[model samples]
Target: MADTSPSEAGNAPLDQMGLDNFAPYLMNRIMGRYNAALSAEMAALGLTTPQMRSLAVLSVTDGILIRELAVYAVVQQSTLSRALDALVRDGLVRRETDATDSRATRVYLT
Candidate 1:
């Protein structure tokens, strides 16, 4: 006969567990669905998820540094840079170098 001990039951497969026990899993799934819906709407405006996020942040904090935008937008600098390039091309955003720090670039919504 197989050993069906109480202790062994604790190691049961995740499929047997309640999903409500995993907050991160639930949150991720919720966000995924939300982004999917929002992405479709934004796509009609010729904007991507990243671009929408950047604009949302810029709306509140215009002339924010590129590095700051990355953090606020929850996007990597390299990825945000590409999105910003497209936004600039579309005349939706303006990119300017910081006067005091030439190495830093700031972005504003146009």
Candidate 2:
């Protein structure tokens, strides 16, 4: 096996690498704080992160397909499916079979 020590690899150790210098770390920290601040407001409205994300995406792009919505909302297809079910049940959104492709479903805000 090849040695991957920091001196041999010419890479700084994680502790030596400042957190701000890491884009993903910074983004995760920011999002964590944002979510913590928003959680209570969302809960009061009976929404989870995935549900809120779905509504945010649907607001701008109504009638988007379920698979596409999952990508745009950054949620898993199965998780979005459950969220959509709740949204539909609460009358916040509706789903209709796609006219062109009967197998596909499109979502719309109500």
Best by TM-score: 2
Q: Encode model 1's per-residue lDDT on 1-110: one tens digit a residue.
A: 79885448675455656677666789999999999999999999999999999999999999999999999999999999999999999999999999999999999999
Query: Local error of candidate 1 at 42, Å?
Result: 0.5
- Model 2 agreement with the true structure over 32-99: per-residue lDDT tens digits: 99988787789998899899999999999999999999999999999999999999999999999999
What is the Å distance of residue 34 in model 1 from its true position? 0.8
User: Candidate 2's C-alpha lDDT?
Assistant: 0.93
Candidate 1 accuracy as TM-score: 0.82
Per-candidate RMSD, Å = 5.0, 3.4
Residue 61 CA displacement from its true place in model 1, Å:
0.9
Q: Which candidate tops lDDT? A: 2
